[model samples]
Target: MGEKQQRDRDLTRWGVSRRYSSLDMFYLFPIGEGLHTIEHKGRLFDLLIQNRGSDTTLVVFHGSLPPTQLTLPCLQGEGVSRLADVNLIALADPSLVMGDIDCAWFLGDRRIGPLRPILSPVIRYVLDSLNSKRTILFGGSGGGYAAVNFAQDFPGSIALAMNPRLNFNGTPSSKLPRYLEVCHGAMSRTPMLRVKRDFMTPNLLDDVNKQQDFDLLVVQNKNDKRYLHRQVNPFLSGVENPTRTWVSLFNGGDGHVPLPREEVAKLLKDLSNMESQTSDEYNSLGFESLGDYKQSVLSQDFS
Candidate 1:
């Protein structure tokens, strides 16, 4: 049999049917100015390649349970429409129902078997081609965890995590049974449960502290029942440079509820426009207090 056919057969053994071939699932097409769809390793990624690009790149990671189809392109479209001009890239997790492994958090780590080999090269290629002076990685929840973990791979990058968990090995949250189901399904397919468990966000942050000069921004809703005190607070205390990190606490919204689109747009605009010679520049950007943040969203005063 041909190598490709043998590989297909092997994937079949793992419950992947031939109809779901990587080539069949992945495609690229332009959706708008500076927006395009890309598929890498049978997963979707969105790119917004703008002419007004700067030395910085904005990498957005989607939250858990993203729709499986046309994810990246949609994100790119929304990003370009709302945020100011800047290069943007977005990646979606493969597991459709669960947030686990959604951020490629297990990439380059001991868990998840050969999945990393399939993903890491693509990520490296994207990052290398950009040659960005700085990269800002941002995501909510599961994506946020990924941004924090992956920021170690890119020196001098900034990671903004919104209500992200530090790890996923513990008991599942009762309120999110669907997410738990997906996590269980994903874990059953990989050796993640048995592999060394030390490569989670907090531990990865330790490595980032030792080897990288990166900034971290964690935004948490004070009313977040799932992760506010449970994960976000622990992560804040564990990081090496607490002085360089910033935490924005908003008062309303459940942990899983998406942040307001306008607030996210404003954040992207601010990040794109700010000069980052030092941490002071990052700190100097005005972030509204929790009340103000909520009021602005209600009043439609993102400008």
Candidate 2:
């Protein structure tokens, strides 16, 4: 089968209907929005400019699907309405692999550097043009992995990685053959594999430890069988400055499920309202485990 046909079949299998072109899908954003597609290094990215501009911009890296699939719809239906004032840019992996455009967890693919040359200039231009003081990176799952990696590149940026798989090399505890297959494919396509060990989370923590300016928020379910051992535990333990990096563990869900749209919106809104923090102060928030968190929720005691 042809590439386009295969993509169509995949989308159909995923219960997604291609109602709009990749670029045209941005119209689903708020009315009177300036949305356009830009080509960088032969890859297409959607840029959405809010009518009433602000110095804050949210860069969204979608999970393992095409941009036109699940991510765009969620942003349009759930995120855009809640974050109408914030500038938004959505990026997708056209290759549909977990390399995430060279933003993988493992230190493989020497050709795939820390930052994509094509995207760096555009990102710099956007930040400069808006005089953006606060840049927030948001993503879930595979996209969350990308967010964490990219957050290091942009100084003083806040990153929210929901249920991120910290190590691509380790086998997922869950039974997800397709996800694993795609990830392996991405790794195989890379020209070189510099690091072979399964220490991606530790390496990431080490990298984050050097930078004392940014905040990394990792959200995961304590009951997540897929990455509790492989990703979350290692990340929480390895991070040098516990004060700067925080983990918010919830109850009653697998690693793959995303937080509710309302809750996510509220968090973004709160962050938007707050002044950017210069120091990385440790906030002892969230629960130690799902049991503790569940008890608090049941007791209606959030304090």
Candidate 3:
């Protein structure tokens, strides 16, 4: 009823449903608050985690905005419940992360404020607990943006950003961007990648390369009416996306992060299978096929 109150129904609109695998979803914070000043703009934040396995953890960050009229439930992908062992975390205070996150970005630049480098330790702590090299990150819109930001600062992580906004500051104002500018104020201007000389070079993306390029997965539907699907082009202008990307653009659910249950199941299964495949079998997926052998070898590391 108020700004801080949260009422949970089915996080199904994001392509997930309660009917699936009954994987335990844990609310790490009733009123999720990430500490600020942990590193500059670093503040307390909320975490929505679905703890699953020791092998890999999937941290799901919501878009950066207050709320959305779209009302797409939290990413209700069947894979979440089915792969119960995979850890999932929605790292953000939805109301604070993105401007009043509707759909554009989940980890609101306005609220989260100029990408805190201080969050590095917390990320490392999570990795240590997971006992893995890089944890799988998930986000649609703003949350997707946050996933990229975090991965840039902390390497050894994979991100599945569904139609993510890869750049910040100097980008044209979109529906969500305009709203965040109006609400969160001077904070959103906090550059994720502060480059005094070339502000337009996607410094965040550049730094991401300096650390790890990420096993980046970009999923988007061509019919998306929110922003232009052309937004996806920025992801690859200077970066190397995953050698083997399993992109599904069919329009069934939300253009951002929605997919049918069966398809979701298949996608997850394939990803897991890819991770488990022997070196040769996994390479067949791609990379060497096009002389991108380096990436193929990287994928093999998962196995």
Clashes of each: 0, 0, 42
Give the distance in Å from residue 3's predicted Cα in candidate 2 to where it truly belongs: 7.4
lDDT of 2 by residue, 1-303 (tens): 112323321222224222324323433432333444543333334444342376667777766553455223222322542453666655544333332232333222223323344454555565666667778788877677767877766878888787886655454732223322343332343311322322133235655667746677777766775665566665565555555566676674664677777666666665655654433222323313323333443234222
In angstroms, the error of model 1 at 64 is 1.0
Candidate 3 lDDT score relative to the true structure: 0.45
Error of 1 at 267 (Å): 1.7
Question: How well is each residue in 24-81 modelled by candidate 1, as lDDT tens digits?
Answer: 2422211223433344444433334433345666777655444353222224224542
lDDT of 2: 0.51
Give RMSD to native, each candidate: 10.1, 8.5, 9.7
User: Which has the greatest TM-score?
Assistant: 2
TM-score, candidate number 1 = 0.63
Worst 10 residues of 2 by lDDT: 1-10
lDDT winner between 1 and 2, please give it.
Answer: 2
Candidate 1 stretches with Cα past 4 Å from truth are 1-52, 66-77, 80-82, 95-121, 127-131, 169-192, 196-212, 287-303
Runs in model 2 deviating more than 4 A are 1-4, 8-33, 66-85, 97-115, 173-203, 210-212, 278-303
State TM-scores per candidate.
0.63, 0.65, 0.57
- By TM-score rank, best first, the candidates go 2, 1, 3
- Give residue 205's error in model 1 in angstroms: 4.8
